[model samples]
Target: MDTLQFLIDGFAVALAPQNLMFALFGAFIGTLIGALPGLGPANGVAILIPLAFTLGLPADTAMILLTAVYAGAMYGGRISSILLNIPGDEPAMMTCLDGYPMAQKGKAAEALALSAVASFMGGLIGTIGLILLAPVLAKFALTFGPAEYFALFMLAFATLGGITGKNPMKTVVAATLGIMISTVGIDNTGVQRYTFGILKLYEGVDFILAIVGLFAISELLLFIEERAGAGRKLIQVGKLLLRPRDILHVLPTTLRGGSLGFIAGVLPGAGASLGSFISYTLEKQYLGKKGHFGEGDPRGVAAPEAGNNGASSGALVPMLTLGVPGSGTTAVLLAMLISLNITPGPLMFTQNADIVWGVIAALLIGNLLLLVLNIPLVGFFVKLLSVPPMFLLPMVTMIAFVGIYSISHSTFDLYFMIGFGVAGYLLRKLEMPLVPIILGLLLGPEMEKNLGHALVISDGDWSVLWGTPLAASLWLVAGLGLILPYIVGPILRRRMRAAITEDAVSD
Candidate 1:
């Protein structure tokens, strides 16, 4: 009953005219951003952070807009996968297996419609799970002390490499670099660590600049290097009608995929890409020969779409409840909250109930808006693909410069952002995962603070780090998180790659 009341009040906040308008606009723009290949939800959110600040949006309104963009981007990623044989983002890779085949068969419209429906169902299921589970998780988290939190942060770092990158060692290097960057400012004891006699360094590296540089600006450089959006033919969407039987045919697959995705999303470091891959793989195995999973089967289109979108929502659970992001995009969103001076954790529910509930309500509303927009306005979004990269690149670069300048009004920050962008490009060239870098930056300071608190309480006794059962259990999990990747990563990657190759050859 209390949850119900809170939800109702949340609806009240989300339905306000200004908030509703932002949600709609965000959904519209996010779909355009997602329809483009190579630009994903993380970039979409990072590119828009300046706009939120420029407009001076309140905490709740900004969250509603950005969350809507996140959800919208998830829905829009399938458009290119189905039509262009190119995934709009990493998580959408599974969608291309059958989606492109359907398009090649002149069923592009049907594929898009089916994916839209699947995304809606998946997002809905995830949101309902969040409502039921977040409060409970928050309550459980209230019992945690500094020692438990330190262990929890370790678990996050340990598991991240397994889920997000091909090489755990490289992930560790990236994370260490980020932590080293984070340590550049004045410490709690008023001692400078790495200021290097520069006054600006006293405040440490501003994560906003780093995020925009790493995600948006670096992506722009990659686009230039690859000459993306060069000559490519788009598959024509034959008809806009979806058969009712097709919906019924894939309903079960969608439900199962959504459920599995939600669980995956709840686990730290297991993100949408994993959810989609597992969903498609499991459904293929379950149905065996009869399913024709990769050969333009509607179930193939539904399963991964449902899985990834569900995982996107599920990623919010740990982020809101435990201050740990479950996915890359959620990490960006976590940065948004931190920038707003809104700490996400157990107390968030009691201390900032309106913001939490309102954001939740906005997600529900945004999902509905995405469903409506994706099906009918898909043609408009697909047209976006025809716009050459030459035009888009400059526009994005302009936005980054203007947005960053507007926020800090500092010329030095602009140069610093460009430096990070160059560094990010180099990291990408080396095949290093960028999310771990952002996570390290976001969580490093907090981890240090908690470790300090625990040591002070234990009078410098190192054993207190894992003295309690909860802390010890977390440490055990962290060790497993590190070791299991070596054991499981190869098998999983090989199977997924084989599936992709098999399907592409079949088509």
Candidate 2:
């Protein structure tokens, strides 16, 4: 009953003429970013966060705009993946396996449309999950203790294996380094610990500065590197046409992927990449010979597209309900919530139902608007690829600089940007997953505050960590976070061997 009233208030907030327009614009720009190669949802959010803040919008509206952008960018990633054989991000790489081949077979328009529709399906399903479960999840979150939070953080840090490149060891090292960086400001005793006496260090290493350096700036550097060896366009697009049958063909895979992805996204450490991989493989398994599964099959395309988007929306559940971000963009959103002085977790439902429900309404509207805009504007969006990277990147960089400068009117920000950009580049070279670092920066302080409170409540009792069943279950999951990957790897290899044998037999 309370949830019902809360949603009504949320709709009122989201449907306001002004907020609606902002959400639409954010989704549109987000699609553009997603269309670009290498610049993903996380990077897009980081670069655009400054601009949204520069507009001086209220925190909820600002969040609405940015979340719309994040959602849109994910929507856009499928365009290039299917049409150009280039994935916009790791998650989109699965789409390209079948999408690019479909384009080669001259089904590009149909392929892109299928992806869009699947994305919508995934989003709708995920929104349902968020609506039905977010409130319940919020109630459950009230049970967290210091042990539970520490366990949750451990799970988040463990996700490196599920989503990262081949080096889990390096991923662990990188996450540990981030946690160590969190120790710089001061100890719980109020005495500065790792300040290094540089005056600037007195307040602790600036985590936001580190985030900008590692993600945004690093992205720019990679952009420069990619441009060094670029060539002229290899494919020509003739017409944008997709029949209704195309959408119908992919609906089954989309639903399956959506349900799986939503479950994955709600889990603390598992994310979209894992969900996409699993869905694509499973769809292939179930489809057998007729479904096309891989080789440009529309279902193959739908599976991953649906999975990624579903995971994206599902990722928000933990962030809103438990104050634990399931992915990087959610981490930023959580940070924004903190910056606005809005406390998230189970209690948030009782206290700020309007904001929570409003976000849900906005997310739904944002995905719908993305579908409406993307189908008709396909040609215009693909044209973005025609713009040389040199022009596009510099313009984006300039926008970033101006936006950041506007916040504090500080020239020093330009220097800060360059430095962070370089750091971002170095981190990339080191095989580090930038998202965890961002999560560390944004959530580090909050995690500590929660720990402090839990300890105080326990009067220094260590067992206070396992006070609730929820906390205990979370701890058990954290333990598995470390073990599951190793167990899964061998199974994956065996499956790959069987697939290879089948390929040989088919050939």
Candidate 3:
């Protein structure tokens, strides 16, 4: 039977008015959640998981709603990152490098519109790839054992750490703190490391709460300080339409980033943030001094938006095909599937083809809907900044509190969120990048788990890390990622300096 036939059938299932309503509702709410600082795709989906059941939707229909929200949240995250110099989510952090500058230059509409278009293209590419490549990729991924997994995560850390922050050391420092924090809770072996006899500490700090504190709460503090004396001037929103030249300029970058992000997403543990950051780094290197990558270049805005959205969609590949959750959001998805008595493995394709393909169809439709919805609403979103700081700050803070409380339902988490908020503010004052911290928090435990599994399989022989071709290649890449940044940094600066000197002479 042709795969196309299954896809067509899937669309029939997804197009039901009830399922369509769920998808649209998820997309709308997801975008709103993503636009708020610190609340992201994971938080949005998690928040809505119970609602899906409450609505008495079927398991497949519920997943359609959650996944649509997942995709929509990723697309919406750039709104804050571009407009406020504050990332709406970890994946959106890369967008801020260029997006905020564009906003400051009165191109908020153009930046947001471009982001929406790029996201649509990326998500479309990813959903298509998922349709065609999931089975093949899933088989390949099955070969990755604990040793290979460990090596892959090391590569992620090295590469991600190398590309972020003004100084690699500072990024490393933030990452180290995150790792330490990750270890604070009970280990897989059942020993609590830093619980301090408090029952609530057994689970350690919540990554979601940390994100809310670090991005949303700290952002509020910074906004207040900025408004302490002279009121801030808001950037005027401009026309939302992009010129033909603008579209043409970003098209190639978008395609390249979208492809790269899909590949990254297919890999376990490599989520949207890593995909977007790596794409941004590659674009910066390729453009060299010409791109002005961190200075409002459209290429800068296009790359990460495409990458993150593509990665977000790509992350579903492993979950659907192999029953392996690739990222935090997908992990939540896996749980939801299990709760509904749906097993997600190789046989699932044959046994539950409708559920699988219906999700894929819904994802594509949701991306199309996001592009249609976000573009015309660009002006309305931009107007959110026009509110007075006194009013806006309280509202934002309260939203953050409510979001965290709703998820954890603990007063302890609320206080913990505030503490992390102060820490986030202080880190910002020290010029430390928060991206690495989030990455470390996400990856550290995964890395340790893989390492432990590898050791158990190899009787604690350390050389097992490089025992296989895949493992060795990954280790080599990790080594290169760690060293190459230091080597390339000085050389790039020298070249940029020479180019500036030549330009000055010509002038």
Candidate 4:
């Protein structure tokens, strides 16, 4: 069947009354989570998966709902980033750097509107990429062996350093710690590692609990600490629509960011956060002088918003095609699929075309629905800023606890969540980035498995990992991704600082 005909049939599945209602519910809940101070798409998706199954949703319907939430959360994250200095998630961190400045300059409405538009454009472009490229990519991915997969993963890890906190060494240390934690479960060879005699420990620490604690709980603590005397300048939003001139100015940047994000998302491990970070950095280098980026430039709002949304869609390519999730949220989705007895891989497109195409159609529809919901209702979202921290923190905390408990019904998981929350707070205080830690935990076991497979295949020859041309090229990129950051980062920082200083003096 032709792609156009497949999409039409998929829309028929997605637009069913029950499926549409579920998609809307998922999107609304996702937006709430994304606009909150600490929770994001990954947490939102993880929190809802159990509920979806508990409600007896069919596997395809549950997948659609979860994917809708994932896409919605990506779009919603910018709400907090732009209105407050706080990022809703790691990907939204870049949005905050420029977006909050716009809010401060009394352009909160403009920033939010542009971000919504950019996110739509990004998602649209990414969906197009998925429709066109997924089949080809899936076919090509079949050729990858364990060694090639490892090289690709290495490349992903190397690129992520670009998004780490100021100190690269600290990022490395945090990631190492996460890898260690991932080793707590039983190995593939059936040997116990760190169960410590606790029966539940055999399954290892759940990433959902870790994420809620790290992002949501830590954020609550920070909110409590910072809630005194200081107040943000909340300006009234006069206009909700973007001017034609503004759209013209940001169009190119939006396109570039969307394209960049899609490519990053296609690569395993290089997720929306990396895409946004790279786009933000590039924008500052190229457009900062003309646009006064970091000082409320609309283009600044457009770039990262587009990049993140695009990357979110792009991340699905690996998950659907290779059965290798490109990010934490995708990993959770992968687990959900496995539990549903539906394996994600090249064969999935042929075997479960209904699910695949339904999801793609839903993503398209969901993005439009989010744009509609975000624009006119933006004022309602901004009202969230007026909520008292004490009330909000306790409410969020309750939600986190309830969501985690709903999964395992285990008090032990609750305590583990709190412990990770404390660790997350400490890590923040020490200026260590938490995403690498999450990534390490998510990817460590998979990387180890691949390494073992490659070694076994090569009869313990370490050179096997670098043998093929594809593997060699991936390793080369990984090496460059690691080393070039140290060399180029300083030069780029110096130049950006000088440019900003010059612009400030000019102002």
User: In model 1, what are the clashing residue pairs, if there are any?
Assistant: none
Candidate 2 C-alpha error for residue 348, in Å: 3.0
Among all windows of 10 consecutive residues in model 1, the one with the lowest summed lDDT is 227-236
Highest-TM-score candidate:
1
- RMSD of each predicted structure: 1.2, 2.8, 6.6, 4.0
Best by lDDT: 1
Question: 255-305, model 3: which lDDT tens digit per residue?
Answer: 988988898787655678767876777887888887876667889999999
Identify the superior model by lDDT, candidate 3 or candidate 4.
4
Error in Å for residue 297 of model 1: 0.4
Instruction: Quote the positional error of residue 256 for candidate 4 in Å.
Output: 4.0
Between candidates 2 and 4, the TM-score winner? 2
lDDT of 1 by residue, 2-79 (tens): 899999999999999999999998898888888888899999999888888878899999999999989989988998
**Residue pairs in steric clash, candidate 2?**
10-358, 30-73, 138-346, 213-420, 214-424, 217-421, 218-425
lDDT of 1 at 75: 88
Q: After superposition, how far is residue 497 of candidate 3 from its true place, in Å?
A: 12
* lDDT of all predictions: 0.90, 0.77, 0.78, 0.79
lDDT, model 3, position 489:
49
Candidate 4, which segments miss by more than 4 Å at Cα?
1-9, 37-59, 80-111, 163-166, 227-233, 239-253, 264-300, 323-355, 488-507
Which residue pairs clash within candidate 3?
Answer: none
